[model samples]
Target: MNIVKVDVFQARLPLIEPFIISYVRLDDMPTIFTRIELDNGIVGWGEAVPDQNVTGETWHSTYDVIVHELAPLLIGKSPFQIDAIHQQWDAQILGSPSAKAALDIALYDAMGKCANLPLYELLGGRAHDTLMVPRVISIKTPQEMAEDAKRYVAEGYKHIKIKVGTDAKADIARICQVRDAIGEDAYLRVDANQGWSRTEALQVIEATQHCAVEWYEQPVKAHDYRTMRHIRESVSSAIMIDEGVQSMHDLTEVIREEAADMLNIKLMKAGGIYRALGLASLAESANMPCQVGSMVESAIATMAGAHLSMSRTIIETNEMVGPLMFTQDVAGVPFDGEQLLLTKAPGLGIEVDETYVSSITVQRACIE
Candidate 1:
C-alpha cells in the first residue's frame, strides 16, 4: 500500500517517581509518536524517545523533523519498501536516529497490519513465545533501594537491575544493601551509564564480585573499548554493551575485538526493529547474548521491543520497564506481571490511550 498521510503527536506523561541516574534526573516524561495511514485505510503507530544522554536528541527537534521533514518525504512512497525509504530518509536527515526510528517502526506497523501479521513475524519470526524482561529499581537510599528490590521480588520478578554510577562508596553500599534485603534470591544487574573511569570501574566491579551480578552494563564510556575490555577481564560479571555499541557496524567491530560478553539493543538506539533485528542476528551468529532495552518509552516502544525480543533467537534478558517507571502510561500493554505477555490483538495489538495522551500533549499534528 502507498502512504497517504503521516501524523505526529507529542505527549508528556508524569513519572510515578523521579528517576535519577549519575548524569541526569528526569521528572517530566516526553514521547514523540507517529501514525501512518495507507491508501486503503490501514493505520499503524510508532514512538520516538530521544535520549540526550545517549543519542543527543531532544523532544522538539525530534517532533519537528518528523512532522516537517520526514513525514513529507514518506508521503508518496510505498509503505512496504521499508529499507529503500529508510535509506532515503537517512541520506537526508542528519543525526536524528530517534526521529528516523519512529518512522521506521510506523512503516513496520503499517505493513504488519496490512498483511495481518505481527511485526516480529514480518521481521523474521519468533525465536520464543516470551522473554525474561528485567525490571529496573531506580537509585535511592541504600535502605530505600533494598525495599524497592524487595517489592519487585514479591511481585514475582526474578531479575532486578540497579542504577549506579554516582559515588563509589554509596554505590557499593547500595549493591550490598539490595543484596542483603533480597537475600540472594533475585538475579542482580548494574547500569553505570558510562559514569565511571577505568580505575573506578575496576574497583566497583571488584567490590561487587561477591554479590553475584548477572551482568554489568555500560560501566565505562562507550568510546573506551580498551577500558571496557580491561574491566571485563578484571571481573567475573558478564559485560553487557549498551551505549558501547550503537550501530551494526559498531557491533561488528566490538565482536571482532571481543570487547565484551553481551550487548544491549534498544530499538530506538539501533534505529528500529529493522536495524535492531539485523544487529541481533549478528550477535546470535557470533554466539553472544543480547537483551532488548528501553529508554523511558511508553508501552508502545516497550511492546515494539517485546516483539523483537520474542522473535529473536539469542536474546537472554530484557530491561523494558518504561511503563512501570511512568506515573501514567499513554499506551496499554501487559507488563505489570512477572513475564511481559504478548497482546492478542491484531498486529502490535495494543491501543494508545489517546485521552490520557491528549491531556499531556505539548504538540499535535494532523494528517492532511
Candidate 2:
C-alpha cells in the first residue's frame, strides 16, 4: 500500500515524579506520535521520544523534521521498501535518528498491518512469548533506593536495575542494600549512565563485587574506551556499554578495544528497529549479549522495542519499563508480574486512545 496521509502530534507527558539519573533529572517526557494512513485506508501508529541527553534530539526538532521533511517525502513511497527508505532518509538528514525513528516505526507498523501479522512476527518471529525485565530504580538515597527495590521485588519483579554513578560510596551502598533487599535470588544490574569516572567505576564495581551485579552499564563517559576497558579488566563484573555504542562503528570500536561484555540497544538511538536489528545481529555475531533498553517513552515506542526484543533470543533482558514510569499514558503495556506479555494484535498490537492523546498534544500537524 502507498502512503496517502500523515499526522504528527507532539505531546508532553508528565512523569510520576522527577526521574533522577546521573546527569539529568526528567520531570516530564516530550514525545512525538506519528500516524500514517495507506491508500486503501489502513493506518499505522508510531512514536518518537527525542532524548536530548542520550539521542541529542529534542521534542521540537523531532516533530519539525517529521512534519516538514519526512512526512512530505513519505507521501507516495511504498512502505515495503523499508531498508531503502531508511537509507534515503539518512541521506536527507544528518543525526536525527529519533526523528527518523518516527517514520521508520510507522512504516514497519503499516507493513505489519498490511501483511496481517503481529510486529514480532513481521520482524522475524518470537524468540520467546514473554520477557522478565529488570525494573529500574532511579537515583535516590540509599535507604530509599533499597525500599524501592523491595517494592519491585514484592511486585513479582525478579531482576532489579539500580541507577547509580553519583558517588562511589553512595553508589556502593545502593547496590549492597538492593542486593540485601532482593535476597540474591533475583538478579541485580547497575546502570551508571556515564555518571562515574573510570576510577569511581572501578571503585563501585570492586566494592560491590560480592553483590553479584549482572553487568555494569555505561560507567564512564560515552567515548572513554580506555577507561571502560581498564575498568572491565579490573573488575569481575561484566561491562555493558550504552551511550558508548550508538552505531555499528561505535560497536566495532568497543569490540576492538575489548571494552564491554554486553550491549544495550535503543530504537531512538539506532533510528528504529530497522537499524537496531542490524546492531543486535552484529553483536550476536560477535558473541555478545544484548538488551533492549528504553528512552523514557510511552507504551507506543516501548511496544516497538518489545517487538524487536521478542524478535530474537539474543536479547536476554529488557528495560522497556517506560510505561511504568509515566504518570499517565494513552496506552498501557500488558504486564503479568515481571513478564511483558506479547500481544497477538497486528502491528504494534495496542490501540491508543486518540481522544486522550489529542487532549495532551502541545503541537499538532497534518500533511497529505
CA lDDT for candidate 2: 0.88
Q: What is the TM-score of each candidate against the true structure?
A: 0.96, 0.98
- Residue 256 in candidate 1 has what lDDT? 76
Per-residue lDDT tens digits of candidate 1, residues 1-368? Answer: 88888888887778888888878888877788888888999887889998887887888888888888788888878778888887888788766778888888888888878888877777667778666776787778888999999888887888888999988788888888888777777889988888788888888888988888888889888867878888887777899888877788889888877888999998778877788878888998899999899887888788888887878678877777887787678776686576788754556767777677778888899655
Error of 2 at 366 (Å): 1.0
As a whole number from 0 to 100, the lDDT of residue 28 in candidate 2 is: 88
Query: Which window of 10 residues has the lowest lDDT sum in candidate 2?
Result: 128-137
Could you give candidate 2's per-residue lDDT for residues 1-368 as a string of tens digits? 89999999999888887888998887888899999999989888888988787788888888999998778888898889888888888788888888888888888888888888999998879897678767888999999999999988998888899898899899999999989999978889999999998778888888888999889999999989989999888887899999987789889998899999999999899998899998999898889999999888888888899999999888987898888888888787898877888877888888888998999999999999
Error of 2 at 326 (Å): 1.8
Stretches of candidate 1 exceeding 4 Å from the true structure: none
For candidate 2, the per-residue lDDT at 64 reads 90
Over 4 Å off in model 2, which ranges?
none
